[model samples]
Target chain A: MNEMIRSLENKPGLSTVGGIDCDLHPASPATKTLLPYLEEYWRETFVMRGVDRLSLAMTSSPSRAPINVRSDWKAESGFAGDTLEAVRTQALDPFGTRLAICNVLHGSMIMHSDDMAAALCGAVNEWLAREWLDREPRLRGSIIVSAQNSDLAVAEIEKRAADHRFVQVLILAQNDEPLGRRRYWPIYEAAARNKLPLCIHAGGSNRHAPTATGWPSYFVESYVAQASIFESQLLSLVAEGVFHKVPDLKVVFAESGFTWLPSFFWRADKTWRGVRAETPWLTEQPSDIVKRHVRFTLHPVDAPDQDALARTLEHIDCDDILLFSTDYPHAQFDGLNALPAAFGETLAKKILIDNPLATYPRIAADFQKEVAK
Target chain B: MNQAVLEKEKNAEAKLGIVDCDIHPAFGTPNELAKFLPQRWRDHLADYGQRSANPLVGTLPYPRMTPGNGMRRDAWPPNGGPPASDLAYLQEQLLDPLGIEYGILQPLAAGSSTLNQDLGAAMCAAVNDWQLDKWTGPEPRLKASISVAQEDAAAAIAEIEARIGDRSFVQIAIPPRTIEPAGRRRYWPIYEAAEHYDMPIGMHSAAFGWHTNSGAGWLNFYIEEHYAFSHSLQSVVTSMVFEGVFERFPKLKLIVVEGGFAWAAPLMWRLDKQWERMRSEVPHVKRPPSEYIRENVWFTTQPIEEPENNRHLLDTLRWVGADRLMFSTDYPHWDFDDPRYAFKVPLSPTERQQIFRENAKQVYRLP
Candidate 1:
């Protein structure tokens, strides 16, 4: 109710002006074949938001569409109103940035079929180039590299990283092999070389069960289950020495909650000697390495744990490791103001304003210049 | 950003009395446990001979359960004796100047262990009886959470209704796993019975059930699953809230025990946010979802980050309301990390007392 972050009240004049996850959908035939799930209204004007785009919650379940637009639609086809345009008219008025999609990752895209996956990748990139990239000042993208195809992902990263518009390298949190099990370090190395952050977004575990046992009846369980996927990412990258191999490499635990960050560190730090005693070659306290290289977003806020959150931050050694993100338009319903309400002004400032600026070194320059003044 | 301010509070720990909301007897006495069991089951254990007959111990054979992992088979009632050894330990080691003024004694074999339910229930009954006798005194330093036969809800309710008359017994302790949606009705009898009893329900985490865990290879170990296990309790909260269990049981004051509060903030915000659309599904509550949490739910802090930086933890505490949360030592669950190790997060002394003891005294009706 009361904001604690007065410094944040200053709302650091973001000269960089990039959003963490701005999703966009193309308007052409490519978009039709690709982002077939998007309503016509959602298809248009997504590029007008910001540079960084994160998750793609686009679903064909018209039932899932935001309210108010269901009654008013201009469509010639079955349930065929311009949904994107409708979204543009309603929701997009305030926030229409960029959309991040995987080129041809594990499983499928709009559809789980291979053809759909490939088509979705092309469709999103096309939308970026046409609706964003050169056209939209704020449109940014991630080169979706399929965990199923590391080479294609590597190529995608190399290609997209060369263009300033492509920001992150999006990989599904699930991997064909356990993330910490080596073999996957090449993706890290490539992204490290390209100076791009490797963003591991959850919801992609191909040929793998969502839960260790059975599916949870509720969506909340499924969402919370994503923490395991992140545990895998943190372990795979750090324990396997990806960060050590590629020192400059940066990783973001996209959409996965940050509370696990400290717990993972607390556990991972003890692993080599405790749970991981079997593997002695592992070097360094997992916390030291993680706090240095890993960054994650806090969204779909897990209702805050006043002491635990603070304890975790102390355990990890920073107030800024948790980057502020609102998984906007996703079922999570994280608003731009979610941080302010979840945390007080003191924490809201770090999580929302300063943390992001600190995590992405590329943006740190401008923040430094501002602080200098 | 305010390291100095937080440290200044850290230096002022002299005033904070470490409030441990939950602790256990390591394991209870078999003879005491024999009282709650059906004779057929009681006799099966007695056959072990006077020297070997421990009612509280069914002897689970998991080799990984060491002294440090919170299940010290020795600190509990030894397999062949009365729970005499652990009682000395609880008062001497626990109640002495560890700064812990009050401790909530729960069933030791109940949480995150391979301990079976029959024995778990038998032992829980034993624990309740033993604690009632041991913790009642003028300076009454110990408090007990009534242990029910959770697997058998009928007998569990009967057991609760039987001993709940003891004033020191202020809460019904259920392994967090037992506090589920499907199990809600089965346990409702206990909640209803407790309506006149005037005690809060305490839900502590144990090695009871597993929600799907993380990596397959990773899931094999308890270390990896502990993180996943924390989220499982969220399932219990969702069940209670979304299913209108809280609505049906308006007087239900449920406490989420041993559940770390880190992830709760997001889940609360997201769930409350969902009310924007799903409120029709749960029309019983007149206010925001947080109102329900503050009104009906409370959580305990253990393994809490000492120099907690998430700062959000305090914010969440503020959101949940300090009066709703309780401080727990998890006594010997890594030594409950010492309360002073925590509460160093730079809250005012009033905030510290509320988190440490005063808040618990109110929620748990602790002396």
Candidate 2:
């Protein structure tokens, strides 16, 4: 491990920052997570595509995705601790320095039948309470909510803002509004008030790149399809002045390639100058706001093209805004070591430890203190 | 033939010993393949060999992408600029430039495009003949994978019999998209024919359409569909494992072309785990899925970028072992990788030799 780290330019001291997506299904606290329908259902779909959120594999499964929010999320699956440990052993502990971002599934869709959004909120809070908070200072998890039920989602954030364990609010990005709409304001307001970053992830169990159409054939094709999602989402958020309203709220474009982050900023800023009159509320160009607020994580790094990412940052005028990530364990994700391997030790140190520390200063200060000891 | 002379001169590089695994031969040009194929199967193939399915996807008003539904165009045969007619130039530029010792020409069209198995036999005959007289036959270093149509066992076997005499042929290639296992009892005739010819079976992926023009109307666009070939291989392996394909034909070997090695370990574990409870599904198998893969199956590496260090690459190589895998360039595809880079990997000189040349020669039993 030391030798590997050395090759990765071991820049001394342990820093608590990193994240990987885990494969744990949300088990009902009342009984076993047998997945009795797992085999009988779209067994082929399960193996090929780890997506079954909408149960598209199961024709019997419903079609619509509601932006649902839980009213009373409270039950615990009793598996959070084990799941974290596995993420560590199988992924984080092996490669990353200290802790990992645990991207969990909040039931399947955004909306629910019975305060479904609230149930997920309470469940997320319970998991944090049992597994993270104080017990594991290094642990950071996303507070999952639905786009369908924004009001209830705000309520859930208000309820749990004091808990540091719930670090970010995660919502699947395929929604009715192009990501930057006023409809997302209430949720942004709540998140800013609570000191939480908002993360928009692509589809997995739920619809991610379901897009205006459907999934693509190759990883390249799928990634290309999502390039627009990031741009459009950024444009929507900035255009609607969600950032201006929720000044303190951080927007993390997690798991998308950071190589394009810089370009998106430049292009948005360029477009806003010519088109800012369409919405005259903003004090600055779209690029300036996003560069100040947006952070990106690297997953599908184009191995042959490493320098391109760094170059893009220079072009977009925001190298400091960039954050390194290893979207671990999913079908298209790389292992934790990928960050270190791809960017050598110096950049890896900055990407893994320093940049994240800078973004969430409280977490960084605590981490720096830990490494000092 | 003299290793002593070649060894003394290191600069006399062997174009880094590139062994192309997923090389394609033109199945149909908009103008020509129709000429060679029986009129019955030609139209269907012509539809698929067009652009990789229509872009406007869905079950709505748009015409769904059926296999062979469009005028399928061969990406190779580079659109009439130069007929692969300059055979000697192929040997000099393609062979000498890459320092490629051997190129295995696999059949491009399965049914009509990549999967129609009825024409799987005839397409194989046409490609093999073209590859020999036109491409590799003159360029001795260019070997070929004999394509076979196993939709009908008898016809596939006859195609093999006709070409078995050619030394230029190395392995028999098939599309991984077929619903039937490569080891099905029905395919035994082709397998036996391969063994008689001392050939291994090499499989490459086609869009699921190779089986029929009505390939699975994927909810996924081309992005997901392109890699779906790996799943097809898994289906092929599952079929083979369950139906006693390996046990019945001990000498037969299956080489998964184009699919990367990262997914293989996980697939083996999943198969073994599922088989534990689902043993009733394949009672014919005695050992675990991993064992069968270790014994009879091997995968080729192209855009191999997993496991950062040379040690990681070697560990994966050792897990699957250096012998089972033989490296290939996947030349002319969007994924074409540098063969020289394989040596740059932190592996020892011996591991390098095995991956580059020795192992391939032995696996395909090439001269």
Candidate 3:
């Protein structure tokens, strides 16, 4: 069995046979590449409005930077993961990703006009569905939406919900406002209604400075600071009473380093004990709410050493809180060993498949259907 | 269960007092600073109040955790004034009852970090005097921080120089949120002054309208704002380290108050990790980031991070170095820590004495 598995792994194609890949990036080739996916009216509108050659890449994660993409992962002339075959060979097949959730992070969230943003989101989703998921059985997609307008975001979610392959909805970690605000509640309502987890990936719309004081001087500061941004978003959701409003909502912080969770949970819970009156909707401790509703992707796995990693996992404690991911072609880690060896087998299986299945009911249901067939 | 253990527990409450490092003393009113200001600034105050970068007038842009605008509900003075105003009331409630030996006062008022430099400096001077007369004068256990409008570097230096030798003042308190990262070369003059005076810079978490509490933008809830305090401290620590503030002033020390210390160890590890990869971008950072943090920075414990298991907290404290941990109450604030119950771990008596009193005494050179 081991010899057969090893031989099959060497084949040049995507596979979700044994494990679930929670995070993978499938780039929208470019604005020009996505033009065919858009309705003709919007396509002409884009050309007439002179919105040609849109860079869709986040400023924080500049596509051209050496740090953004690994040297080995890049294709001959363009960026890695720009094509379906490259994603298959580099991410899915190599990592033995039984199922991979594609988070198409093209800078649609930054669009100033709600209509344009909504239209671009529609285009991105259609592109993912037709170009990636339709062609690849192992691939699943995130429903891209313009969080700037809840009505539009809801509409987008409803439009994409018909496809069971799209298991989650995607939003940038940095947004115009907190994800818990009522303005964004409709999006959550739609996501919850469709059993889709609201996945907050590491990229941002660059709508604001990445830190509290102001724009950081270096890229590393901005990069390291996203975890805090995710923390604020989590606190916002808890404090502004979002979980109470949308009880079934599941959150995935993809590319957010997981080591900060224990301390953050501690601080949040501690503060809630004193200030619970302000946020009356919080019925349980912040950590309790988080453990039940939130799942973190393990990409950065940012701990100083093996002992530190062990300590972080011990603090996290719960088996269901982490999901495995390569964060493919994004230069987070080196080689095929995306899951750190220190994680061990039991936790590895949970992160790779079980936790993800539990988090996304629709995906689990689909997996059941596939097995029966 | 033993008689000696019971006696030690009882004795721990009575005389083993905490040297509370973060006691906020607010003004009874903005008008309290009138005596310290000149006519032009006074007229400006009447017409414009504080022309701060934030929209609100002499208040935080967002409300905080509790009823008395982030103050402990019980901390409100019996005489119908703002909390932290009446010294007699503070002593009666916080100092006397908590068995506070030497509580360092962090006067958070309308001064320092305000836009109008002259008014800010004058109000800071006034706040310092008020700290001396109103809070510390009758209460010998209370110590003062020389408040200054940090933007006006020369004026800030002058203020420090004025109070350089005064034993009544122990440190220079600067707000965590500033126009730039507090370690920018523009702010180095203040560090120079602090080092020359042998005073540690107290960077307390406070709202400055110059920017949102979190860089991603304004947070919705006070809980989020509260969490952002540690995040702000993280930025300040990074700013200090990457900007070579330590290399510049080898003797200078920093005490980050109210922003819990559990994040300190991890942040240092992260900073060091990133510095290794991006060292060329910031060549001035002489040593690994953790080295600068361990040697130069001290963290106050308040709103302490409480993991479900006490062992995790102990491990974190071990990583942060027991000597670097100073016990702070954040007295009169909503989230004040009771030193007796704050630390969940079983600290050795020597560890307790160091964290509670000796560490602070050593840092501030207290007699």
Candidate 4:
């Protein structure tokens, strides 16, 4: 039994050199940090309201939760990715990441007031560009948008589109409504026009319980239920004709574990066959549509062992869907052992370097420009 | 017959007498269910006409894909009644042909956890009585689930108490979509009663509740709505595990019906991983979440996940052990699985017997 368990364990020494990290959560800027980026009136309003003193980080990922910060990665500030230096040395340097995308999980995106959400989201993008992207050559930014108001969200996306450093648009997996509804199509339209892959990360607005049932007592229940949120959004995107409407758009499910994909795809495809009339625009199979337009990041592999991981990947069938990610400083994996040994060399290269470049067009364009230089 | 031929026939007969964990038994007519309801509730049903959490009055919020309310194309009876509503038709279409020796009936129309608590309890009692009177009494091969309004624990417990000694009722049926997550203390009395009565709770995937099908909110299409069934059950399982349901009711067994089982292994892994880091938040959960799931939960396989490669499913079955699976056909539904072809992968004789027959028998405690 001991020998069997040992053999199932992932072998060490799988190097992730030059890998493009697709989902890295840089510490959210405190409301005070964003005051400089916000407009003058809003800035003063924040100070007067005492919001400037608030951390504004997502409650779903409390700083003190051991899952939120690895013991070794935690800094004196009581968080792991609090500063650019911390992110660089702790995440980038260790993984040998060629380029890492920064996803900031600030509470501002989920604010109920559309105007405040938009203002704070815009400030977050600007703060991200100036504070993190401008400082590190290897860093990239995801335009954090308030999904509550698509008009404002699209404006923010358009504002940030000119910056090549910004490669994707970020939104929570759980929002006011399902992301595929026409109410939010303008955001997808803007993302497609700008060639930015929309990254739906795990976390929500608390407009509803994290589960379809009512609220959970423990955070672990909320955390584990994130995968289903991703599933619902994926189905919505396919069923609502988002892919058909915006053919150029790409979707990235970050921190949404990939092991659930196989079963989800099966259920989606099977149900779609019988229910195709309701979704007339879905001319193709749901799984095929997902494979064509969607990509998932690798973190919290969720499989029990190397064999299970390999089997899950095989069930997923498509090799191009997985992009490499560490979900850095969130304690997904220990040390630099981010890529599972089960990925093998060939698949690892696709997940690490090829898939991300293909998913994020700006990154590919930037890499091309760098090569020419 | 020759002695060798007789032996071969005996073995084949034994193997063919498999237990199907999920077989829907619908009412023959609207009056069939009404007959079981108390006259006062019957009058209420006529006046109010079954108020649900869904927005639509008569139709489902998300309409089913297939005709005859998502029934199999051929499931409509020759004499004209809803699919699975006619016992003779059901026997012809599923039980006899599929060799279902013990088919557990899950009545989806119960709406046991609907928002109107009093009406919900009344509907549950009516459905439970209807199941016993119409189905189990006529067909000894068929068994009933004691449907209850789980939100009203006192009423649910009363319903359980009213049916405890009956061998015809094999398990207690609760809707996966409850007013609250099933693990909350408000629902503990029902669990306690289930434990005391030695009845496993069968939480079948349901569509109606106060909550939207998805955690994110109401989805646009039926495909998305159908997909939410698995997610609903996933949350229930997660809620139960983390909230220490198993720790409290150590001997209580849960059989998740209609919801696919392939997601179980991954859910267990995720629960264990989070428990290691966030155990302080749920200290009452004495062991890893996976331990409770392994010890307490049984998964029914219907609408079985058909991956691109069959071997991948075998790997999942291996991870979620063959002992944990029970065969379910979801008969008369559009996405029903044919028992012969449901499992694409090869199973050893022991594994096949366990999944197809013995496991469900043990969980439901059937003769």
Best by lDDT: 4
Report lDDT (CA) for all predictions.
0.53, 0.52, 0.81, 0.86
Query: Against the true structure, whose DockQ is highest?
Result: 4
- DockQ of candidate 1? 0.13
Q: What is the fnat of candidate 2?
A: 0.00
Clashes per candidate (backbone, < 3 Å):
66, 50, 7, 0
Identify the superior model by lDDT, candidate 3 or candidate 4.
Answer: 4
For model 3, residues A1-373, the per-residue Cα lDDT tens digits are 2232122122232223478888888765588877898888889988887665666677867775555566788887658788889988888787777899998877777688898889888988998888888899999999988788899999999989999999999998888887778888999999999999999987687776677766667776777778788888888887777888899999999988777888887888888888787778788999998888889998776666656777778888899999888888876555565766667778888888999999989889988998999
Interface RMSD, every prediction, one decimal place? 5.9, 14.7, 5.9, 2.3
Tally clashes: model 2. Answer: 50
Tell me, by TM-score, which candidate is best: 4
lDDT (Cα, tens digit) per residue for candidate 3, span B1-367: 1222312443453457779999988777758777766788789889988778777786787787666678888888988778888888888988888788899999877477778898899888878887888777778899999998988899999998887767889999888787787778888999988898799999899876477777557877778888898888888888888888999998999999989988876676667656754666678887887888888999999979988887788778777888999999997888888776788777777778888898899898888
True contacts kept of each: 0.17, 0.00, 0.48, 0.73
Instruction: Indicate whether candidate 1 or candidate 2 has the larger DockQ.
Output: 1
TM-score of 1: 0.66
- Model 2, residue A155: displacement in angstroms? 10
TM-score, chain A, candidate 2:
0.70
